[model samples]
Target: MASTEAPEVLRYAAFTGDPAGGNPAGVVLDATGLDASRMLALAAEVGYSETAFITGRDEARRRFSVRYFSPLAEVAFCGHATLATSVALAERIGTGALLFDTPAGEIGVDTVTGPDGKVRATLTSVPTRSRPAEAIEVDATLAALRWAAADLDPDLPPHVSFAGNDHLVLAAASRARLADLAYDFDALTAVMRTHGWTTVHLVWRESEGSYHARDPFPVGGVVEDPATGAAAAAFGGYLRTLGLVTAPRTVAVRQGEDMGRPSDLTVEVDPYETRVRVTGQAVPIP
Candidate 1:
């Protein structure tokens, strides 16, 4: 039997240039004839948190229609995968703006080489919205995570924010709390399923502009996300909604260190808008 897939898929690590760091995502740059089942199969074969499939393209406009699949199901939008895909395209097509027609909305990405000679990319998210988390929902989440009320940061209240997907924003009281991430995966999965949550954004604020984050994504069949660009974008909106930070500032969210895959994401927010801009560089994972 021969595989009919064309334009061989590429592997890249997003949020960090180091091959060993960042979250790995499979990129099918040209998924001309690939269907939903085939894409999911490919993603499972790749065994990454997610895989990005570019179904349609406009060479003249440098635009593409992208779909994301996890090992289990499809995703509305995936920031790390988008970054990985942009980096892959930039490596071959040269750095510039690329448009993506995603399930969530149309997104614009710009790729550029930093002063250090790394190919970095920035993605602008769709309009974001945040609402207070219901008491029962928050309580169940805290219990599933094995965290207590004292473990939460008093300054940052519990909220559910959405950019491309829904995520529960939980602020831990200390870095130590965020570091120890032994949670009940099944319990969390059940809670998330009930609430339609993609990830729980566990965070510890190091400073006004610096933060540490971990995402438990049991619903995706992953214990934790190495780097979560979508959650970073949502967190930016969360901060804005809560009046936690001044707008038009860049906040750094560090993740994957505890998992031994240190990743960095820069989230920018403007005072007047609800969209968040996330930036990071990716490298091919050979």
Candidate 2:
């Protein structure tokens, strides 16, 4: 029998004002009693891309310990969940700074009213890093996606990037290449598991500080993610690592359009700093 007492879950879609757009996330403001199994079950029931549970809190510092769950597993960190959680907290406690002690590291976020009069949240990730993807791994990944090396963008090289979680970043030469996203789910899942990757951040850069993105989350039992915070952070790091963009700059990411759930992300890179900041607005999903 299922437990009668379950924590109430708040639903929010991050990165979009419209409830029907963005990535849906389950936000549990207080999860003191929820265990791993319970959280996972709740996530499965919610059927969102991911769910965030706030376990511990410090009123003085406005800090909390947050855990993230997908239907099948726990992730070290999640961008969408963090954004959702921050907005949820802001609604209750009012807009301010919130610190999160995530599995990956301590992250700081700020919630403030936007010019449009809506509450928006921004999270500054831990130090970001990136490395060249191994040739063998790249080959395997391409095989799983049924993509050829020639299809890759010469300007944007492939790399394994990390801000909170690791992501394989690949830039498509054209928007068409990015739009046609057919891949072997099982094969990609196997490769992602072996590589300890959370998602594959496929992108087509439109211009400096603007790009379209798609995330393949086979490892999490999802074909594609409408919006991915972690990947955005990592991709910001990738830009910095490659000197693709000047620091102290903000970049815009448009994702989930192909899936019909559009999302927007703002990534800020500080000069001489490794941490990347991602900001977005989340609204309740009726």
For each candidate, the alpha-carbon lDDT, in order, equals: 0.92, 0.93
Using Cα atoms with residue i matched to residue i, what is each candidate's TM-score against the true structure? 0.97, 0.97
Off by more than 4 A, model 2: 1-4
Instruction: Report the C-alpha lDDT of model 2 over 1-286, residue by residue, as the tens digit.
Output: 3344888899999999889999999999888887888989898898787999998999788999999998889998999999999999998889999999999999999999989877899999989999989998899999999999999998999999999899999999999999999999999999999999999999999998799999999887789999999999999999999987664899999999999999999999875889999999999989
lDDT for model 1 comes to 0.92
Candidate 1: minimum summed lDDT over ten consecutive residues — where? 1-10
Please, what are the lDDT tens digits per residue for candidate 1 over residues 1-286?
A: 3246555779999999899999999999988788888888888888898899999999789999999998888999999999999999998889999999999999999999999888999999999889999999999999999999999998899999998999999999999999998999999999999999889999999999999999998888889999999899999999989887664899999999999999999999886888899999999998
- Candidate 2 colliding pairs: none
The deviation in Å at residue 33 for candidate 1 is: 0.4
Model 2: which ten-residue window has the lowest total lDDT? 1-10
**Which whole-number lDDT from 0 to 100 does residue 89 have in model 2?**
92
RMSD of 1: 1.7
